[model samples]
Target: MAASGISFRVAQAVGVGGALWLSGNIAALSLISIPALVRSQTEDSVPTSILSRQWKYTFEAGKSQNPPIAVATATSFCYLAWSVRAGTQLGRLVPRNSIALYCIAAILTIGIVPFTIIAMTPTNSRLIAIAEQKRDAGGSVKPNDEPVEVLMKKWMFLNGIRSFLPLLAGATALVAVLG
Candidate 1:
């Protein structure tokens, strides 16, 4: 019983803490980093190479960092859910609602990976290709695609949507905890 409580606390800490941290990181990029970069230039046109490098650096970093956090968070939440599932530890003591909420958190937290692959991949690929093409040209190369700002704006929108997942996951877990 004491061991179960200790493990439960650990899982709750990781699940809730990781969800909030992931959401905060993603939200900062969508709300602060991307917009600041997009608005930095005073000219009518923004530079593709600059945007590309910036996007590439941040995207790569996030791609490496966020998925692991998401997985850990979801795994923690899964532990919580499994603890309360049938024929499992603490199943009799913990309520059914928390199990359901933890399951939801696990889904929403881990869902960011597939969301990025499916929903954000097109824009990411386009940006990467444009960046490679234009970085050496020093923005003198006329883009064959849409304006870099337009594409970036689209990316910001998509990223904003993505940021909500972990936030929602965190909120769900919080609700479960409060209950």
Candidate 2:
């Protein structure tokens, strides 16, 4: 019935439901696998048997990373679908409230993107090398070295900006529909 234009609202509801269901499952898997990955990373300090077993499980489904990445993509789809539904629902049902919903959706979507990216990206040890270089060159290094946190905050700020464009596009579409 998806091919048929049964009703935009019905279709949207189905689509949003599917996205939410898939996202929930993916989020569960991510929550499960994340700790295992962390355990594997710290495996060296653990028993060899335990380390090997954790490492094997972590990589068993293909690569050590595929599952997480797949989950990431699924989550992204979830967010995109959620945004669509929010815009559509707001416009259709609460025309006056659409603006508020649009803004909220945009903020949430934008806020999540950077966190997702940072979670997925591997930490580059080379970044520390650069930091070290500056310190060795007699450059004044800050007493409290909080590089990772600093970078994460910056990345999140940029991600908010990154998310704004698509969200703004969605909001624009919503405004057009309302007018």
Candidate 3:
């Protein structure tokens, strides 16, 4: 019983930490990176060239960071899942809100990957294609196929939503711990 309690506490800590980490990363991307890109687009540098360069760097950074984020999120989800199962088995020993918190955290943490796939992947692909085209053409391409600014705005909006999920999850989980 004590062991189970310890496990629950550890899981809650790790899960909250992971959720916060994800939230912070998304917030940074939305607040810092996207805004910087938008500002860069307005500069004297050709918009396509600035976008292409930024996008390439962003893609590379994402590729490098993705694995660790995935691992941390997966770990958090697994622990939260275990907590849910244990809470169910323990019945009255665990607060109902605690179980709900674990479930919410698990769902939100796990959901991010699929959300990215469904919500963000298409826009990302389109942006990457445009960036690549611009780069290949030696920054001469106009990105004439689509409105780059509109796409960037849309991406930023979606990213704000993405950032919110983990933030909510982390906050809920923290409340569960304190309450």
Report the number of the highest-lDDT candidate. Answer: 1
Better of 1 and 3 by TM-score: 1
| Sliding window of 10 residues with minimal summed lDDT for model 2 | 122-131
* Every model's TM-score: 0.91, 0.32, 0.81
Which candidate should be chosen as best, given TM-score against the real structure? 1
Off by over 4 Å in 3: 1-4, 84-93, 134-138
Alpha-carbon shift of residue 23 in model 3 (angstroms):
0.6
Clashing pairs in 1: none
**Backbone collisions counted per model:** 0, 0, 0
**Candidate 1 C-alpha lDDT tens digits along 1-179:** 89989999899999999999999998888899888778864353555677677778887898898988999999999999988887766777766788999999999999898999999999999877777773343555556558777777889899989989999999999888777
Q: What is the RMSD of candidate 1?
A: 2.0
**lDDT tens per residue, model 3, 1-179:** 68877887777777788788878887787788877787777775546756766866775686577547745764765665556555365445556666677667667766767888899998888877777763455546664566666777778788789888878878877876776
lDDT of 2 by residue, 1-179 (tens): 34323453443333334333433433433455534444554563443333334434432442343334333433443443343454454334445543444444334433434544564333323223323443434444434343433433343344334434334433443452344
How far does residue 125 in candidate 2 sit from its true spot (Å)? Answer: 7.9
Instruction: Spell out the clash pairs found in candidate 3.
Output: none
